[model samples]
Target: MKVKLYMATKSAKQQASIIGLLFAIVCFMSCQRSSNNLGVTENMEKDKTDVAEKIVLTDEEWKRRLTPEQYRILRQKGTERAFTNEMKHLGKGSFVCAGCESELFVSDTKYDSGCGWPSFYDTVDKNNITQELDSSFSMKRIEVLCSRCGGHLGHIFNDGPQPTGLRYCINGGAIKFQKDDEDNK
Candidate 1:
């Protein structure tokens, strides 16, 4: 009976060790994939400046220019609560970068993705935005930034409506709406 109990305990310990090893291996592989997709070996510095016509400001200047929440999302890459963003329901206007006021998405391109964020099928100009591979939270995503100010806008995904087949899931806090005057009249 004593021998059986000892063997059982040993088997449990071995199983736990195996599970732990498998978890570690999974984590390692995930990280490896993320790293590979992050374009670490590429000339990221050169690529960053491809959209070089952008606004540059000091931290203090940005803080002064933006509200606390705006600074958090635009500068710190933070996301606002879905369905809570005021800009999600905006109509008939252009969405401009909160950091640099660069025209990003037009109203026609905006669509209800039902993903709790303001989704756009396209931007006003490709040069108005920049994309980088984000590997945060163990997820590989394409991060979109304001080319003018390099502020974090949000992520872009391939699953979107036709014409572009790209969904620009933008942070509402990262943009400000400019309504057409005719609509207001």
Candidate 2:
């Protein structure tokens, strides 16, 4: 009877150790994520841009304005496959919303985040974009949108370089790049 009791205690101890190890791992990952969030704006306050400038279009009008791929990503919240977009190599330009042509990001803020999509550390104007808490796909994320047209540009992650620590993982199809005049020459 004593031998049986000893074995049961040993098994319980092993189970406790495993649980402890798992908890430690989860804590470590959470810390990593949170640390990267430094410099990111916690409160997504609306910028005092002119609401009158907002472009409200019918579904059919949007369909006509944007390409099919752009329509999918911007209007339907779809993601493009990584590293396949031409925007990755673009230089000296401004990225505008595909739906409303609103200036969103500048080429100076663009960086290669190795995330496949175009990553920007900042926007040309903070008032041009909006963010929402997206709890889709069993994960929590900040979804970035074009404030004027309400188009889904992409998701913004805290895991980015300094200054803002924001990686705007935008779908290439969701934006149109206008080359700077100097760049064109």
Least well predicted 10-residue stretch by lDDT in candidate 2:
27-36
- The true-versus-predicted C-alpha distance at residue 148 of model 2, in Å, is 0.5
Q: Using Cα atoms with residue i matched to residue i, what is each candidate's TM-score against the true structure?
A: 0.72, 0.76
Q: Report the lDDT tens digits of candidate 1 across residue range 12-43.
A: 99999999898666633432332333432232
Best by TM-score: 2
Task: State the C-alpha lDDT per candidate.
Answer: 0.78, 0.81
Model 1 is weakest, by summed lDDT over 10 consecutive residues, at 38-47
Indicate the TM-score of model 1: 0.72
lDDT tens string, model 2, 1-185? Answer: 99999999999999999998886565333323433343457667655667799898888998998889988999999877666789866778899998889999999899987667788989888889988777675556677899998999987878778888778878889999999999888
